[model samples]
Target: MSKVILITGASRGFGKIWAEAFLKRGDRVVATGRNLAAIQDLVNEYGDRVLPIQLDVNDREACFAAVNVAKDHFGRIDVLINNAGYGLFGTVEETSEQEARDQMETNFFGVLWLTQAVLPVMRAQKSGHIIQVSSYLGLITVPVLGIYNASKFAVEGLTETLASEVKAFGINVSLLEPNGYATSWSGDSAFQTESMEIYNPVKEAFQQAASTPGFFGQPEATAEAILKLVDAAQPPLRLLLGAFAYPAVKAAYEERLASFEDWKEVSEAAHGTSIKTGN
Candidate 1:
């Protein structure tokens, strides 16, 4: 019953907690991060049960190599948690082209590369789960995080399509859309663009909204939820974690639906009805 779970970004936050949780439940874990030192303690504590590898998700070759390492060590990988990504804070205009590309490379293309590496193995075995750690921003955007949102939105689309394509192979793909959690996600791990004086007011308001202090979800709880998801007979394609995620995502979709319906007539008018007797 003990399965091999490969987790990227296992050095800290939700990734670290999830790794520990799996270890506690007697599952084998291949924990990878850009910094080996970050996962050294886990390797020390869990010994052979944990394999800590240095991996930069943004590197395509490195992603494939890491998957090979895991497969070699564990014989097979049952779960892959794509948790390697950072928050990029800035307006679309404020973020540099390089910064935007970097964000996409890590958050979107990284997931794609890793998934591609693992799919062959899973396809041969006829069973596996791929979990993408997306964000509430994937569903709806807020100010100053457009690049980050774009990356996650890309992830959302990628994983959803992947799920449909691989269902016949017994592969389950999921997107975890977590809202604010008590993690370093907003601190050291986050990257910010050069601040513009004109956008200071908007930035200040966004910061104030984020800083409101109550009931941020804990990493451990999120880990537990993920474990439950992993054990379920049928896991969902999209899951929202944290208390804030549900209401916020629901409201966002509702508003989107309302807007679409309001414009439905105009949208339909754009295409005239085809004339009959064309045959």
Candidate 2:
């Protein structure tokens, strides 16, 4: 059976690539973006297999409306790719109030709302998959992307809870933690805060890291992995994209584990003795 997939940010990057891949494989796609024209090419090329919608996911009501529209148009939604977030480049001290809020609104709240909207639909059908496009930064923070890291971290927590809660309903949730990809994301889709003199070295380091060979994975190669995921009998709750993600995340977790072990005495001290039922 052909699956009906709903993709946000379907105009470009992985969203566009995966949307086209699904259509080419004879699946239907509800392709959405902030601008209608941005997704029109999908409609023109794939014809009835794609439904292009103009949606800004931050609007709470619009998020619900978009889900309804897709459900009404497609009859059922088998997969949802929350792929509509951007990177905010700024250190913690350099980021503005507005910049931080906007990052959460899209990267965090946007995913929350869309997931909420589709929950009922998925529950009714007893099957669906939600794929959140988080980053490896969610697990390990970068100097200049503090706010972006926070947003992905929030998504990480949210989606983990979602996975456990929705499993009984035959719904699967997955997070795509890509290390980096050669997308316009670091180009025009990115937002950079005003530079500060003190953070120049930090900013320079980030730029240099981005230019490193193998830092950014080829986005085209991810289609097979995605296809395999959605087709799996049991899809993972987290899928790390790119060759760089696993080692990076593993090292971060190892460091974190070391800290936890180091603080074991303090942590257990805080707990004190176990409470007695007789008391």
Judged by lDDT, which candidate is best?
2
Give lDDT tens digits, candidate 2, residues 24-133. 89999999998778788888888999999899999989999999999999899999999999989889999999999999999999999999999999999999999999
Model 1 segments beyond 4 Å from truth? 274-279
For candidate 1, write residues 11-57 as lDDT tens digits. Answer: 99999999999998899999999888988888888899999999988
Report clash pairs, candidate 2: none
Against the unseen true structure, what C-alpha lDDT does each candidate score?
0.91, 0.92
- lDDT value, candidate 1, whole model: 0.91
Q: lDDT at 59 for candidate 1?
A: 91
Residue 139 in candidate 1 has what lDDT? 93
